[model samples]
Target: MCFKCCLFLASLAFVYFAKAFGGAYMKSSITQIERRFDIPSSLIGVIDGSFEMGNLLVIAFVSYFGAKLHRPRLIGIGCVIMAAGSFLIALPHLLQGPYKYETSVSHNKDVNSTESILPCLSNHSMTEADDTPDLETKTACEKAAGSSMWIYVFLGNMLRGIGETPVMPLGVSYLDDFSREENTPFYLACIHTVGILGPMFGFMLGSYLAKIYVDIGSVDLDSITINYKDSRWVGAWWLGFIVTGTLILLSSIPFWFLPKTLPKQGQEQSESKSKSTELATVAEQENFLPEENQEQEEKEKPVTFQELAKDFIPSLKRLFRNSIFSLMILTYLVAVNGFIGMITFKPKYLEQIYGQSASKAIFLIGILNLPAVALGIITGGFVLKRFKLGVIGAARVSISASVGSFCLLAIQVFIRCENAEVAGLTVSYQGAPQVSYNPQTLLSQCNMGCSCSMKHWDPVCAYNGMTYTSPCLAGCQTSTGTGKEMVFHNCTCIGEMMTPGMNTSAVLGQCPRKSDCDRIFKIYMALSVVGSFISACGGTPGYIVLLRSIQQDLKSLALGMQTLIVRTLGGIPPPIYFGALIDRTCLKWGTKQCGGRGACRLYDADAFRMTFMGLITGLYFLANMLWGGLYIKIVKRQKKLALRNQAKENGQEGNGAVNGHANISIAKNKEDEERTGEESTI
Candidate 1:
């Protein structure tokens, strides 16, 4: 039995691991997906939130009815569905022939050709008709828009969410039902611990994959102009889905063989009345009952839909009537809003605000931050179990953790890096940094005759520590080697900024941030790690408060309702609104192949930092405020319950003392009467 139970646990853990890995990998690949599809952050946010919408559609039904069904088989079915969804998410990569990025240069031309297509010289010959795209291009653009391959990813992710709903509620309840009460927590902890490792490996996988080109085998890597660090780079984001999907499929196999139910663990030694005792009492009642009573006993039937419907409303009311439970849900909802939005965009934040590559950002989060969270969760559970904290005690622990983490998070707003020096965006053509610029500002004396297109975003780094929007914008009239090694000679704009006798050539790609930004990034990461760990330490304790505050019989309903409400409201809206707000800070938007705005190629670093961090901080502040109120409510309720119990105990003791005195007096009176009767008789 123990071995079988262990097998079940191992299977469940593997399923948990696969799902978590897939989810994290999806988040880690957000930037890649955004670039691949040429979509805005707000649209990507919608795709990300689709998973929650799917869960919202089916969570309530699954939570209530799934327990009565064969839980293992149900979980197995969910896994298969999740696997299908994973495969579907990868379908877009197969359908979309190859990613085509906007560029001004012709890579197909020979590098050794004597005749060079100089961007600055060539711009003089471009007429009005040449600027407008032809009919073929317009038709292709219409076709691309009609296809909208990202819908597949959204649907696949939604399916994954729907499938995942059954795993947590059913699996946890099943384990609790069959396992010994003392061992349940240990089992759950083991599963969660193993589950956390999935995200670690998932992010690591994402980091590794992000360094490789998206169309790796099909395309020539040598011809690609962008490196992994470039904003336009698209990694093999779809591959992780296939790998994780297979794992989820394989994880489902063991569940089919497991029994629907198991004999309660340690049932033989259990002091409480067991199932067999109840059966024996029923047998005795049947033997002694009258014929009509026997008939009535026979009329006992299986529970029907109407009975369940009748019970649900009152159960819901009972669950919500607990003020602590309602407040806990509200606090969690507010906290989760901050958490979801922050995590979804944290990689983007690192890349824009701190000058970290997407790969490096994901790698750091996996190795440094996620481990801290794992440790914090373990510590929280240990502290709660070791100290055996009650509802009020748990609330205090969560509040302390929240306040500490909030302070640490607030400190991070000041730890920021300066904006990157990009020509025509953050800086002028003459090397002067500016807070804002218009499209006309991209033109200057050096590049005015060149007529550079502001829509194109082929960045080139000049010798004078400045980045131009393109070689033409830099007034470069000379050739480049090829791809990443390409460089332009006689850049007029670069010469204006350089000292006399200095070379006026420019290299491919934007210039990296200054060395001091690296130091700032490291500090930001350290503070982030500390804050994440501190916040995670409150997770398990806060959960315990929710569990303790609700009615025992309505525990499942309460949990299900909480999941539905929090996920529907908190999970779905945060990303959309956060992404929309962040989009306002885009310094340069990428141009699509069809002559429309694409994903943002560059963001205003200062604005991006303030917006992203400010939104997260404000949400956390509100969450902390809610947590404070929740703590106060828990304390008040605890005190009232304590006082009420004490009064009841005092009243019972007083009544017992009065009854004892009355009995003693009655005994004495009987004895006195007996003595008087004896004297009279004498």
Candidate 2:
């Protein structure tokens, strides 16, 4: 490759890294944004889908017209737009006030001692004029609570989708056009290998940032009631966006200086020599054919818009007519839908199923799973090149990896941790599975007289191992300590345990599940990493199959169309539907101070695992079925073509032998006649 090609490759790699970083960061921060905005999972799903909506808007037009335009400059413009979107996403963090997590525990020392008074008694001394909820107070509170800053995140993500339009189609096509054919796979693999690192780093960044409080620099750590493990905890999710945006802006600069096109490396000279040799051989075999040369030149002429428009329908028709290509697209669509849904909610699933904190989940996925995937992709590409695999070999590799991954996913369905023993949701106060759910079920005889509001979700784990809705619900007569260390004493709920001389105190936190659950979680993560690695090994080969199946002229359009369909059908809907389904499994919902439902605080683990893994497994099963059929078709066709070529070669050799014998016989006859005439003259 020339200097410009090298620069273009580097620029494209940088853009890939930037975009992947931003996208993965968004995924990693989904839980934080949900908690910060006090939105439901379904609504967060819609916000996530907005990015794909923006992609749907301009991808087709950009992909088609970009081929005729300056591809490098266009990609640079896209990077700038992406950077702007990232900045927009982070804007809400700057504009919004400091993060205030929802908590029922009073910040005042006096309020913390309210248990000294009878639980049912209202303290006149505590009531003040400003504390009264007058009409003005209500209105002002509503105004402050109604801050719809989440809209900024949605719009910013959408802008990111629009900005990302040119990166894949234009960048890949430009690279393919300039590089030697054999080197294309390795080049792409290197780009993707570097690109995968972006997500790895992005998720790691998310994990690191999640550990710090959202108001880290401004707030006192002692005053904060929650830790990173708390469901209500909100981290500095916006920081990664700003960092990625800056990198994207920097990545765009080099592309501006790079040329629009570069000569194909090494192949141009060889191709020219081959063409000249073929023409000379043709001239010796037959008279020079000017008409054929003119026709070949005409075929190479640049297509006008009018001509292109007329042929557009025909081109599309021809593209879909290829059975292998169409099947590949379908299979990819199914696989993408499953992959998108799984990745979008994997962290949340881990939190709910395995009783892990969001930070821990994101961190594990970043450190363990993403690197495995990156290695798998690189290995897949290397396998393809090293083995010199054509379509059939690539198909086999793709199908084998996919099926192997699916089998591991199936195993995950069996190796699951049990449901969390949350009070009155999954399990009864008696520490047994509940047959049915009712809000009134929370009102056990122990604390019904305390008049606790079921809406308040201040859980306290009693000495008996059962959790209560709040310290008030636990009928705690006294309290000690403060913040996270605070404990409630003389709890009536623990008294119902009927244990002789047991301490009847409850602490200010949810009850943790058995340690066996943690062991199960570790096993699950191990299986997850292995499955991810195996599945990702198919990615490069599958992509190569898609690229090779299409006509060279329509490579950009084919890729653009594939993205359009997969993103529209797969990207936009998976998160929405997955979130909506997962929302159904929520056992406890958080409440906003402004009198509305917030994010889910707890989930039924069994139901969540079943739904999440079931959906993924079903989609993969379908995709594998399609792959099976595609593999059969590809192998049969390849075998037939091989036989046909072999037969043609045999026929050509036979004809050459006959022609050689005829030339030798004529030469012998001419020599023999000359010798006879010379003897007669003598």
Candidate 3:
């Protein structure tokens, strides 16, 4: 490649990296945002889908028009817009007051014991004068009610979608146009490999940040009641956005200096000379036109707006006429739907099913999963180039990878942990499944005299393996230590549930599951890593098929159309619907301080695993069927074309031999006739 081409490729790669970083960070922070906003999974899905909504609005027009305009500059402008969106996403954090998490502990130091304090309890001993709220207190309470700030996050994500519209279509088309035909795959692979790194870093950043409290610098660590493992814990999610936005802004700068077009590397000079020579040779051989006239015709032809407008529909029609390209789009559409949903919720799945903290799940995905994907992409590209695989070869590779990955995913359905044992939700205080959803069931006979509220969900795990909704429900009269370290003593519920010789005590935090669940999680992670690598191997080849199947002129439009279809159908809906289904598996739901249902605290693991993996597996299986049909067609078409070309060459050679033999026979006859006439005259 020329220096300029190299620079443009680097710029494209950087842009890809920056965008992926921001996008992945957004995905990783979904759990944190859910807790921070006290929103359900379904609502979070809508917010996640908003980015695709923005892309859907402008992707087609941008890709079509951007092909004709200055592409690099358009991409640069897109990056700026993305940066703005990122900043906007973080705006709520600065504008809103400090985050307040729900807890059972009182803020006052004098309240040593929480035994007397019940959820929504009011002291009737107070006089009417004490019951009245002051005007200042009322005003402060009203001002603090800013939980609706999640709207900013949704708008910001949508804006990000708009900004990302140009990057893929424009960048890929630009690289393909300027680079050598064989080199295009490797270049794209490189870009994607670098892009994959962004997610790794982004998720890692999210993991690190999730361990830190949302109000770390502003709040006292000693006063905090919840750890990162707590369900209600909100992390420093906004900080990653700010950092990502800045990087995206920087990535846009290089594109401004790049030219709109660059000469094709290694062939620019030779191609011009060869074109002129070929034209002259053809003219002389056919006796058709003068060399000067041909030269004049070859000179620059200015394209007008009218001509471009007229050609647009015809170009689009020509593009879809190819059956292979259309099938590729359909197959890709299904695959993407599965992939997007899986990646978006994988961390949450890990957290809920395996009893992992959000931080740990995000960290493992970033550290292990993304790197494997990156390697797979690069390796796929290498295999293509090393083997010099044509269309058929690429298709076969893609199919193999898909089949292998699908099998792995299917196996995942069988490997699962048991559902969490939460009191009053999944199981009763007596360690039996509670099929009914009744608040009254939480008020057991053991703690009925304690006056505990059924609404409170501050669970304390007793020594007997059964958990209580709260220390008060456990009928604990006293507590030791404070914050997360606090332990409840003289627990009546524990005594009722425990065996004859066991101690009657309970501690803060929910009970941990069996140790075997951890072993299952490790096994799941190993299979996940291998499956990710195998599945990602098909990515580059699949993309190449899309690129090569379309006409060169329609390359941008074809890619844009594919993106539009996939984003609209796959990208926009999966997160929403997947989230809704996963929400069905939530065994226990958290309660907001302002009085409404919040994010899910726990899920039925077996149900969650079955739902998530089953959906992905079904989508992949359907996609594989489409791919098989496409492959068969491709192979049949290639065979027919090969036979036709061979027959044409053979016919031309036979005709040339027959004509030569006839000329030789005619000359021999004429020589004999001349010799006979001369002899007779003598």
Best by TM-score: 1
What is the alpha-carbon RMSD of candidate 2 to the true structure? 10.5
For 327-362, candidate 3 gives per-residue lDDT tens digits of 888998899999989999999998888889999999
Candidate 1 lDDT tens digits, 471-584: 888999987577777778888998888888899998888888999999988888899999988988888778767755655446556677888889898989998999999999
lDDT of each: 0.80, 0.80, 0.80
| Candidate 3 residue spans exceeding 4 A from truth | 109-143, 268-307, 433-438, 651-682
lDDT of 2 by residue, 1-682 (tens): 5666787878788888889998999999999999988899999999999989998999987887787677889998999999999999989877777777666566544444434433322222322232346677667765675458899999999999999999999999989887876788889989999999989988999998888888778876777767888788889898889998998889889888876666668622233457778767556534565675465456457758776567667666666766777888899989999999999999999888888888899999999999999999999999989998887778888999999999999999877777766666777766778723456777778776676666667778887777776777677777767677777777776787748688988877777777898898889999999999999899988888888766677888888888888898889999999999999987778876565578988887878889999999999999999999999977765554454445456564235664454444444434322221111100
> Where is model 2 more than 4 Å wrong at Cα?
109-142, 267-311, 647-682
Query: Against the true structure, what is each candidate's TM-score?
Result: 0.89, 0.87, 0.87
Q: How many clashes (backbone N, Cα, C below 3 Å) per candidate?
A: 0, 0, 0
